[model samples]
Target: MPSAASSEAPSEASTAPWDVHRLPRADGKTFLVTGGNAGIGYFVAEQLAGTGATVVLGSRDADKADAAATSIRSRVPDARVRHIRLDLADLASLKASAEALRSDRLDAVVHNAGVKFDQPDRRETGDGHEAMFGINHLGHFALTHWLAPLLAAAPEGRVVTTGSFAATSERLDLDDLESTRDYRPDRTYGRSKLAQMLFGFELDRRLRTGGSTVRSVVTHPGGALDSLTPPRPPLHAPTTGERLRGLPAGILVQGKEAAAWPAVRAVLDPSVTGGQLWAPRIFGLRGPPGSGPSAVIWRTRRSRPACGRRAAT
Candidate 1:
């Protein structure tokens, strides 16, 4: 429901006329998107609000979160959008937000908060997990778990986790999850994404097996350019990878576009079964939304995201 122009940026491939724009409003559905202030998260919040769904922009930064909600309301004059503070790195804040939400049932939740290799120093959150694992995976894991009861109250709820193709290079090191002894920024970020993907897969498997009606889906926005994403070829190395060699790093897709395609598909696409992975159809994963491959990274023996698979109740 964001302004049609908000997501109108061109993509790496031919752009679609955003049928999402025409979809009817989601009158009764209520959604919460973490990191919903900037980048893809903001776009997701805006679009959902455009559908007339009550959107809660869960954000870590108080100011940014407020600004995002304000912008969404501005874009959609009647949008019933609001903001909530949720520092994923801190469980206390996540819990407080869960308790404060007035809605008893959440129609869907999009876990999109993440950080890449910007900071080289190893970081540990309040919960003591590696900064990447803590914020990107476990923080979300705990938040979702705390809200599962509310989500389950809905007849057909869904959970969407944003992952990245960068995860392909990741392998979880449970023993070194905190990265206390060694710090490799890029690899750590990859590990965080890997955790998210596995958590999605694991969440799906458990949900299906438990016969829970609530659906869980995962998405990987591959090759999309964003602030969190490394520069093409990564400044650390200039001439690597086919996608990185020449593509105008910024031309891949706008954060809004990259997020819109996948977020819309994940929440509204009828065929989007639980556990499905959605990405762009074109080279950048920046085009029309379509199912994409779940990387083999989560399948490897080293993945330690099993903890995320645990069921509530």
Candidate 2:
């Protein structure tokens, strides 16, 4: 974990609110962001690359990763970025991607790739698990297992997981790990997100117990809409009524750039600690990054994070 004092300096260094543009130099550091082809992931990768970090864009599609890297280069003329083919739905691919990084130590790993919504019917991955649970939770679980050693090798290594508001509504049913019985798409996705929170906080507890400096932090981009993001492929064409209703909701919705703030803060901000959750400042729907405990993780009225055994679910 980075020194709390070091992270505090930047706050006093400037009067401007914390954002990606204000991050300190990252010249020699390295970061890997899953789902970096587009959305918040792409923007995060671009922001880090702009800060001189060697960013690796992990995506299932090599072409899309290349395009994202090219876009980053176009913006940061000298940005050093690379691509690694990663399919979080496949366990074998996750292992292979980890192996590809074996020779290099990583400063941070951003678990940003996940199925945003779900299909009408529940689907399973090659691992024979529910699609959302398999990709969002288990896949990242396995990836962290495989890469933890590499991350541990770095100074104050960090792991940042993308969580969701769904966690606030869903209950974690470890017994039904795959949601094999009467699975509802939305509920299953919620359960998966809750699992993500559990895993992240639990990992922090384990790391602390094991006397490791690595930190595990979770963040969410609340109510961010694709309509507010940059133009990209796989455009979500909202229906007329959807747009009509979204007009009022748009006040609460933000672009992907704003959505990426909390995750970026969790990953790079030295003051942030393990087991803490970050979200937007305004009702967690939109605004600058803010720190707090997840409602589901500890169910506390106070903002204090779960520490030690309390972090264990």
Residue 241 displacement in candidate 2 (angstroms):
14
Per-residue lDDT tens digits for candidate 2, residues 31-132, read 999998888898888878877888988899988888888888887879999998898899887878987764568899999999955567878898798889
Q: What 10-residue stretch in candidate 2 is worst by lDDT? A: 1-10
CA lDDT of every candidate: 0.72, 0.77
| Candidate 1 residue-wise lDDT, 157-196, digit = tens | 8999998877766656665665666578888887788778
Off by over 4 Å in 1: 1-18, 226-255, 295-297, 301-313
Each candidate's root-mean-square deviation in Å?
Answer: 9.4, 7.2
True-structure lDDT of candidate 2: 0.77
Q: Model 2: which residue pairs collide?
A: 1-213
Distance from true location, Cα of 237 in model 1, Å = 29
Q: Looking at model 1, which ten-residue stretch has the lowest summed lDDT? A: 1-10
TM-score of 2: 0.84
TM-scores, in order shown?
A: 0.80, 0.84
Model 2 bad stretches (over 4 Å): 1-17, 232-248, 297-313
